[model samples]
Target chain A: MLLEIKNLQASVEGKQILHGINLTINEGEIHAIMGPNGSGKSTLSQVLAGRDTYEVNAGEVNFLGKDLLDMEPEERACAGLFMAFQYPVEIPGVNSTYFLKAAYNEMRKSRGLPEVDAMDFLTLVKEKMKIMELDQSLLNRAVNQGFSGGEKKKNEIFQMAVLEPKLAILDETDSGLDIDALKNVSEGVNKLKSKENGFLLITHYQRLLDYIVPDFVHVLYKGKIVRSGTKELALELEERGYDWIIQEASEKSVVA
Target chain B: MMSTTLPTESKEMHPYTERFNQLEASEWALDPSWLNQLRRAGIAHFAEKGIPSIREEEYRFTNLKPIENQTFDFCCGAPVADPGVSQVQGFCFDQLDAYRVVLVNGQFSKDLSDLSGLPEGCIVESLNEAVRNREDLVQGRLGTQVKVDQSSLAALNTAFFGDGLFIHVKKNLILEKPIQIIQLTANGDEGSNPVASHPRLLAIAESGASFSLVERCVGDRDTAYWVNSVSEFFVAPNASVEHLKVQEESLQAYHTAAIQAYLEQDARFTSHSMAVGAGISRNDIHSILDGKNSEAVLNGLYLGQKNQLVDHHTLMDHKQPNCNSHEYYHGILTDDSRGVFNGKIYVHQIAQKTDAIQNSRNLVLSDRATVNSKPQLEIFADDVRCTHGATIGQLDEDSVFYLRARGINEARARRMLIHAFASDVVDRIPYQAVKDYLENILADRFDPKD
Candidate 1:
C-alpha cells in the first residue's frame, strides 16, 4: 500500500467533522470521494494536509513509511504530499516566480540538496508552464491576483509539476472551470500521473470523474464512508442519487 | 483641554522663556511691509491656537507638551559656519555633480556650501534674501496652501521659522542634477536644557518643470537637542517633484517636522519620509489636491527600538474631481518601544470620481513591543471609491520555520522576513542612494537581537 488511514477522526472548534474514517490506496490509483455539502470532504483533505486549525482526535496516517501527521504544511509538501486548494489565496505584491522559488527552495532543503537560483529557476518554470499551457506573463505578475478561475486552477497544477509530490489531493478543482478549461486541466493531470504517484480526487459531482477516471469510488455520507466499489458504482450513484446510502447508514446506527 | 490637569512641571517655566520673550523682533520692522504683516498674523494665529491637546481628533496620537516646554531662541546674527562636516558624515558625494546648501543651527552657512551646477534661471537663497528680493515669489505662495488651523504644530512652525532653503525652478526647465540640503544641529554646553531650533524650507516648481530635493537632518550622537522643521512644496500645472526627507538624529534628541503640499492640474507629487532615530519624534504630513487630474503618492517607514516613541500622522484631502491618492506605511518595533500610525483620507462632496487607498502594516518583534494604528477614510461623495486597512501582527511562524528548516539560522530567517515585509514600501521610493541608505538602516534596526 502507498497511502493508508485507520480510524481517522477530527474536529474543528469543538465540533466533530470527520468520524472514524478508513481508507487505503495503492500506487498509480485514483480514488474519487463524492459527498454532499458540509459532509467533511474538505475537512478530510485539510486534516491530511496538516493545516493547524483542525485537531485530530484519533488517527494514524502513514505515507511511504513515514508519519505524515507529524509535519507542517510546508514540510508535508516537501515530503511528497500536495494539496490543491478549493479557494487559493492571493499574496499581493509578491511575484509569482518569487513565491514559487521560495516554495521550491524549501522542498529542496528538506531533501538535503542545494537550491536553484533566479536564472535557473526561471528557465525551469518556463518549461513547466508550457506543459500546463499557461501564459508566460503570469510568472511576472502577483501570485493568484486578477487571475481567472481556470487560470488559478492551472497554476495549481503547474505548482504540482514543480514540486513533484508523491500523493496529490485535488479539492473541488473542477467547480469553476469551463469545458475547455476542464479538458486542459485534465490533460495536465494525466501527464503528471505515474506508477510512482497516487491521487485522492474529492468532488461533489461525478461529472469531473468523466475526464480524470478513477479506479475506486467511495460514497461519503455525513462523515464516514457508507459504500465503496469500482468506477461503475459512480455511474450507478449518478443515476440513483445518495438517498439510499444515507438511509442505510441511518438504519445501521439504529440497529446497533 | 486640561481635564487631567497634573501639576505643571517646574521645567515648563525655565529661565530662558523670559529672555526669549524680551528679545522682540527689532529686525522685522526693517523688513518688507507684507512680510511683517504675515509674521504678525502667524504669531497671532499661534497665540489663538496655543498647543495641541491629546484629545483633538487630528492630534490624538501625537503629544505637544515636549515641544511647548522648550524655548527656541532666534539665532539672527551672521550665518554660522558648518560645524563638524567631517564627523558623523554619510555617503560622501564629493564626486557627484549637484547644487548643495548647508545650514547650521537654523542659519544658512555660505562659506561651507556650494551651488555651482544649477541652471541660469534657477534661484537658491536664504529665507531672508528670498523675502527681501523675491517678495512676489515668497508672499504669493507661503502658508496659503496648507490648512494651518487643523494642526497647532504647523501654526507654531509658521510663527517661529527663522532660516531655511528657498528654491525656485523656472518654467519649462528640467534640472539635470538633484539639489541637496543638509541640516545639522550641534551639541551645546553641559547642564543646560536641550536647545531648540526651527528650520524652514520652501520649494516651488513652475509649469512643465521637474526636479528632486533631498533634505537630511543629523546631530551629535549623545547630546540633547530639539529640531522643529517645516517645509512647503508647491507643484504647478504639468510639473513633477520628488521630495525625500530623512531624519537620523541622536538618541537623546527630540525631532518634529510638518510638511504641507499642494498640487495643481496634471501635477504629480511623490514623497517618502523615513525616521530612524531620536528619543521622541513626531511627524505631521498633509497633502491637498486643489485642481483636476492631480495625483499624490505618500510613503513612510518608522523603526522604533529600546524605549523610544515614534508617531506618524498623515492626511490626504481630495477637494477637486478626478483626483487620486495612495498611501502606504510600515513600522517595525522592538524591545519596549512604541509606534503609532494614524492615516486619514477625506473626500469632499465636490470631489467626485476620487480613488484612494491606504494601508499600514506593523511587525512587533517582542512581546512587550506595541503598535497603535488607525487607518480611516471619510467620503461624502457618492461617486467615489475609497478603502483603508490596518494590520497589526508578528512574523508568520510557519514562514520562519520554513526558512530555518532550509539551513538558514533563526536570526537570518527573521531578518529576511522583516526585510520582505518592508520591501514593498521601500521599492516605491525614486532615488537610488536614499533607498539604499534606508534599506541598510532598516536591516540594522531589525536584527534579531538588536
Candidate 2:
C-alpha cells in the first residue's frame, strides 16, 4: 500500500474539520475524492501533508511502512509526498527558476543522489515546461507573481512534474483553470502517471476526472468518508448532485 | 541658536572640549589657524550641550548613556604602522574600477589612495591637503548645511574630525568612475583600551557636474571602539549626485554618523544608506531641497540581530516650489535586536506644488525583536501631495509554508522569504558590484550552513 489513514481526526484553530476519516490507497491507483462544500476534503489532504495548522487530535498515517504523521512538511516531501496548494502563494522577488532548482536539488540530496547544476536543471525544466506549454519567460519572473489563474494552475502541475513524488495530493488544482488550461494541466499529470506511484486528487467537479481517470472514487460528507465505490460512483454523483449522499450521511449519523 | 559665548577660564569644560584643546596644543595640531578657531567654537558648542538625553523628543527611542560613560583614545590624524596598507587593500571592492581614497584611523593614507586620471578641472584630495590650495571653497561649504543648533553630534565631530576627502568638481564634467571613500576604524594602539575617530567628507558638485560617491565604513575585530563620522555634500544647480554608504562596523563598536546634503535649483540627489553592523548605531540623514524644481530620493535599509539597537532619523525639507521627494526605509530585526525608524517630510507654506512620499516598513523575526516605525508629515502648503505609511510585521505564515511544501526545510524556507523581502530594496541599487557584495553578506548571515 502507498498510503493508509486510519481514524484521522483533525481541527484548525479549535474548529474541528476532520472527524475519524479512514482511507487507503495502493500503488498505481488514482483516487478521486468527491465531496460537497465544507466536507473536510482539503483539510484531510493538509493533515496528510503534515500542515501543522490542521492539528491531528487523533490519527495515524502509514506511508511506505513509516509513520507519515511523525514527519515535517519538508520531510514528507523528501519521503516522496507532494501537495499542490489550493491557492498558490505569490512570493515576490524570489525568482521562479532559482526556487524550482533549489527544490529539485533538495529532493535529490535527500535521496543521496548527485545534484544537477544550473545548465542541466534548465534542460530538464525546459522539457517539462513544454508539457504544460509554459513560456520560458515565466522562469525568469518571481514565483507565482502576476500569473493568471490558468498559468498558476499550470505552474503547480509543472512543479509536480519536476519534483516527481511517489504520492501526489492535488488540492483543488482544477478550480480556476479554463477548459484548454485544464486539458493541458491534466495532460501533464497524465504524462507523469505510472505504475510505481499513486495520486489522490481532491476536486468538486467531475470534469477533471474525465481527462485523468481514477481507479476508485469516494464520497466525503461532513468530515467523514460516508460512501465508497468504484469509478461509476463519480459519474453518478456528477449526474444526481451531492444532495442524495449528504442526506444519506445525515440519516446514518442520526441512526448511530 | 543659543548664545555662542565661550566659557571663561575659571569654568570647567567637558572632556570632549579638553581633548580638542589638548590636540590643538600638542604636536598633532592642524596647520590652518582659521580651522583651529572653527574647531574651538565647535567643541565649545558641544561642551555646552552634552550627548542628547531621553528627555529630548527627537531622541526618545535612542539613548547614548553607554557612549557618554566610555572614554576612547582619539585618533588625531596620525598615520600608524601597526595595521599595514594591505589591510586597507584587502578591505576595498577590488572588482570596482574606480578612484579610491582610503582613510585609516581618521587619517588619510597616501599609499593606499589613488586619485590619478582625474579630470583637469576636477579637484579630489584629502581635506587637510586640499586646504592648502582651495581653502576658500572648502571653508565656504563646510559648515553651511548643518548648523550647531541642528545636531550636537555633528558639531562634536567638527571639533575632532581630522582627515577626509575634499572633492570639488568643476562644471559640465562627469566622472565615469565613482570616488570610493574607504573608512577603516582600527583598534586602539595600546592593546584594547577602546578608541574613537571622527572622519568627515566634503563634496561640492558644481552646475552640470555629475558623479557617484561610495562610502564603506568597516572595522577590525577583537576590540571595542567608537566611530563618529560625518559627510556633507553641496550640490549646485542642474547637477546630479548619488551617494551610497554601506556601514559594516564591528559588532562590539559604537557607530554614529550624520549625512547632510544641500540640493540647489534643478539639481538631483539620491542616497542609499545600509546599516548592517555596530552594537549601538544612530544615523541622521537630512536632505534639504532648497531650490525650486529640485528632487531628492532617500532610501535606507538596516539589518540588526543579537541584541543590537539600530536607529535612523530622516528629514526631508521641501523649501521651494515644484519639488519632489521620496523616502523608503526597511528594517529586518531578529534575535533580541531592536530597530527604530523615524521619517519626517516637512513642506513649507511657500513650497507649493510639492510632491512627497514616505514609507517605513519593518520585519521582526523573533518574539524578542522590536521595531518602532513612525512617519510624520508637516505640510503647510495647500496644493501639495504627500503620502506616508508605516508597517511592522513578521514573516507571512503562508509564504513560509509554500516554500516548505516544495521540499525546502523550515530554516531555509524562512531565509528565502526574508531574502525576498530584502531584495525589494536591494534590487533598486544601480551598481552591480555593490549589490553583489551586499547580497553575499546577506546570504552568509541568513544561511551560514549553505
Candidate 3:
C-alpha cells in the first residue's frame, strides 16, 4: 500500500474533527472522498499534509514505509505527498514561477538530487503551463496575489503538475472552478496520474467525480467513514442523496 | 557675558581637536556678519542641548554611547583617491547622464565632479563659495525656511558644518539630469582616531522650476567613522522636487542624518531615503507643507543585522489647506538587531482638507530581534483624512513551508522571502542606479556566509 491510515483521530484547537478514519490505497489506485459540508474532508487532507494547525490525536499514517505523522509539512511534500489547497495563499512580491521552481528544487534536495538551473527550470514550467493552458503572465505575477478564484484554483493544479507526487490529495480543487476550469484542472490531474502514483480526491458535490472517476468511494460523516463502496456506490449516493445514507447509518447504529 | 563666565577647559576634546577648534574660530566667521551672528547663536543652542540621551523623546530609540566615546579627528584634507564610479549592472538609466557634484569629507571636489550638461539658470556649487559670491541670494534664503529649533541635529549641523553643496533652479527652469551629490569617506589608520565628517546641503527650487537631487553617502570598511549630516530643501510655488538620500555607510560606522523640506503653494515634493548601514544610525526627516495645495510623499527602507540599531523619526506638518502626504517605511531586522519608527502628522486649524496616511511594517527574522513602532496625529482641523498603522512580525511560517515544500532549503527560502519583502519598498525608488546599489549592499548584508 502507498498510504494506510488506520483508526485516525484528529482535532484543531481542542475541537475534534476527524474521529475515526480507516483507509488504505495501493500504488496505482485513486480514491474519492465525498461528503457534506463540515464533514472533515479538508481536515483529513490537512492532517495528511502535516499542517500544524490540526493535531492527530490518535492515528497511524504510513506513507512509503515511513511514519507520516513525524515529518514536517515540507518533509511530507518531499516524501511525495502533495495537497492542492481549497483556498490558496497569496504571497506578494514572490513570482509564481520562481516559487514553484524553488519548491521543486527543495523537494529534490531532500531526495538527494541535484537542483535544476534557471534555463532548465524555465523550460520545464513553460511546458507545464502550456499543458494547463494558463496564461504566460500567470508565471510572472506575485504568487496568487491578484488571481481570481478560478485562476487561483488553476494555479494550484499548475503547481501540482510542477511538483509531481506519489499520493496527491486534491482538497476541493473544483470548489470555485467553472465548467471550463473544472475540465482543465481535472484533465491536468489525470495527465499527471501514473502507475507509480495514487490520488485522494475530496469533494462536496458529485460533479468533480464525474470527470475523475475513482476506484473506491468513501462517504464521510461527522469525522468518521460511515460507508465505503465501489464506483457504483457514488452513483447510488448521487441519485439517492446523503439523507438516506445518514438515516441508514443512524438506524444501523441503533440496531447494533 | 556668557563667554566671559564660561569654564576655560572642557572634558578631553574628540580627536580632530585642533580642526574642531579651527572650525570653531575660522576667518569665515568674520567674513560674513550674518553668518557670524548665526554661528554664535547656533553654538549656544548646541551647548545648551548637547548630545541627547535615552531620556529625550527624539533619541529614545537610539543610544549615543558609541558616538560619545569615539573621538574623531578631521580627516587630513587630502584629495579623493581614484575610486571609479561604475554603472550599476543589470539596470539601465538613460536619464542619469546629466549634471553631477561629488563631495569628499564634507568638501566639494571639483576635479571628480561634472556639471556640464545642465540647463540654463541652474546654479550648483559649494555652499561656502555661494555664500561669499552670491551673498544676496544666500543671505536671503539660508536658514529662514528650515527652523533650526525643529531638530537638534539640524541645530548641531548649523553650529559646526564647514562646507556642503548648494543648488538653485531658477524660475521656469526644468533640469533634465538630476544633480547628484556623492559623499565618500575614506578609511583612517588602524590606531588613529575615528574621523567625524558633517556634509551639509542647501537646495532651492524657484517658482515653476522642477528638478531632482540624489545624495549617496558611502564609507570605507575596517575603520570606525562618524558622519553627521543635514539637508535643507526648499520648493517654491508651482515647482516640484524629488530628493533621494541613499546611505550605505560602512557597517562599522555611526551615522546621523536629517532632511528638512519645505513646500510652498502648489508645490510637490517626493522624498525617498534608503538606509542600509551603521553599527548605530538615526535618520530624522521633517516635511512642512507651507503652501496651499502642496503634496508630499515619503518612502523609506532600512535593513539592520547583527547588533545594528536603526531609528527613523518623521514629521509631516500641514500648515495650510488642501495638502496631502503619504509616508511608508519598512524595516527588515535580523540577528538581534533593533528597528524603531516614530511618525507624526500635525494638521493645524487652518489646514483643512488634509489627507495623510502613514504605515510602518517590520519583519523580524530572528527571535531576539526587536521593533518599536509608533504613529501620532495631532490634528486641529475637522475635515482631515489621516490614517496610520504599524505591523511587526516574523516571516509567515506557511509561506516558508510552501517554498520549502517545492525544494528550497530552509535558509534559502527564508532569504528569498526577505529579499522579496524588502524589494517591495525598494521598487518605489525612482533612481535605478541607487536602487541597484542598495540591492547589492542589502544582498551582502542579508547573507554574509553565502
Could you report the Cα RMSD, in angstroms, for every candidate shown? 5.5, 3.1, 4.2
What interface RMSD do all candidates show, one decimal each?
Answer: 5.4, 0.7, 2.0
Instruction: Pull out the clashing pairs in model 3.
Output: A103-B406, A103-B407, A104-B406, A105-B407, A106-B407, A106-B408, A107-B407, B16-B72, B16-B73
| Candidate 3 residue-wise lDDT, B8-127, digit = tens | 744443333334456656545355878766655655565566677888887887888777776666542334344455421111233465466777777776766777877679999988
- Best by TM-score, which number? 2
Q: Which stretches of candidate 3 lie over 4 Å from their true place?
A: A5-22, A36-39, A53-80, A104-136, A176-184, A187-196, A221-224, A236-256, B1-24, B74-100, B116-120, B186-192, B447-450
> Taking chain A of candidate 3, what TM-score results?
0.97
lDDT of 1 at B69: 74
lDDT of 3 by residue, A37-59 (tens): 99899999989987788989998
For candidate 2, the per-residue lDDT at A129 reads 78
- Would you estimate the TM-scores of all the predictions? 0.83, 0.94, 0.87
**Tens digits of per-residue lDDT for model 1 on B1-450?**
363355644335333323323323554557766655655565556666666777777666666676567654445333443465454245234443456777777667665567876688788888878878888898878777543564555665565566677889998788878777777876455664566677888899999888888777887787778887788889899888888777888887888788878889888888888878888888878888888888888888888889778888888899999998988899989888889998889899999999898989998988998998998778899999888888889987655543433234467556777877777888887667767777778767766554
Error of 3 at A112 (Å): 8.3
lDDT of each: 0.78, 0.87, 0.82
Collision pairs in model 1: none
Model 2 regions lying over 4 Å from their true place: B1-11, B23-37, B78-82, B191-193, B448-450
Error of 2 at B408 (Å): 1.0
